[model samples]
Target: MAESLGSNEVTFRLSRCRQSVPRSRAALHAVLGGWGVDQDVLESAELMLSELVTNALRVRVPNDRQVGVRIARLLEDGLLRLEVSDAGSGRPEVRAPGDDETGGRGLLLVEALAHRWGVEKRAGGIGKTVWAELKAPDIVAEPVGREVAAVMVRPGQQVRAWGKWRAVRTVRTESYAAGGLAIVLGLGEGPALRVHAAEPLTVRDDSVPSARERGEGTPG
Candidate 1:
């Protein structure tokens, strides 16, 4: 049985390191529902946990040993924490991989999405614990957080602001199709309007047109 920390916190220890990533992620989504974490956070957390736990297993522990994942919600404080620990001694360092390098971007992604992240010295100096945290969405903020809202734009949709921080913004795309475009907000640096893979598109700028336009779209 997994250990429970108060009503909101859950810690699971797995003897089989292989199960650490998937189990921790599922536990987060399953248990932390009412806390109002966004899907992007959840997905990023999953990938982060996978990388962290995998590093602990492959780099630190012997093949036979295991790792632990702790998921806790500080309800009053509005913080969600994920901790992954293994019985290995060395701490992880973030390295900038070369352009041709294939695999070392895990911690990079974690650093980008997580509001804060760090590693701590475990008791007895035997090993270390890596943790990442995300702040719960402030519902009272000015920008009304909504699910994907799709809008079509004519040629002149003004590009006043173009990023994720804004409550409202504008996006444009090359072609149209039925259910062809979904304006995915809260994506990395900006709101994204995603056209389904099958749609035809023409490119003018170095970057793709923001598929999901958040601002008012004038009729063509």
Candidate 2:
């Protein structure tokens, strides 16, 4: 079970298995939910933590040792600090992942999501700690604008943009600044657009695209 260490800190001791990722996310959901965190920030934090904890659990640890997950909510600073520690020796870093890579693309995701992040040695000299900070008051994505710039749209799908429904020409994840997915709309003829995926939109029957967009993060 997760425990609240104080007014703004929470910690969880995770088992040595793949299930720990979602389990830890549930723990964070519970703690952050109670603290009135913004829905967007909460979800982004969960995604980032999923990546960090998954990275932490990947490295080999000592016999019977488990990963350590800690969260510190700096409300005054408007930042939520998260740390994942393991007894492994390797450190986490960001690098361009190959197109055929199946996994191990988490560092890139972290660089795109968190406000800032880095690695440091643990206190007991056993292993290193990978940490990230997420800013609060996350942008609540609302339907506040139509005719968004052709570049700030999802690719490979039809969207209500550019003053009409258009199919996205080409799309790729992690192609935008700040870690959201990017797609080239106007059937690959126009400039790239910035986009974040929001809730599943309810489009009328005639408005739906043949192939809808999908990804780990969001579309514009």
Best by TM-score: 2
Poorly placed runs, candidate 2 (over 4 Å): 138-220
- What tens digits encode model 2's per-residue C-alpha lDDT throughout 2-74? 7778667888789888889999998888877655566677888999999999988788776478888998888
- TM per candidate: 0.56, 0.61
Q: Write the per-residue lDDT of candidate 1 for residues 1-220, one digit (tens) a residue.
A: 4777666677877665566667766766775543445555566667777777777766646766567778776545556678888778777878899999987887887788788999998654457889988765321121322222234322222222332232223444444454454443222335454644433333211222221232222245
Q: What is the C-alpha RMSD of each candidate to the true structure, in Å?
A: 14.9, 17.5
Following a full C-alpha superposition, what root-mean-square deviation does model 2 have from the true structure?
17.5
lDDT at residue 195 of model 1 (Cα atoms): 49
Instruction: Check candidate 1 and list the clashing pairs.
Output: 171-213, 193-211, 193-212
Deviation in Å, model 2, residue 5 alpha carbon: 1.5
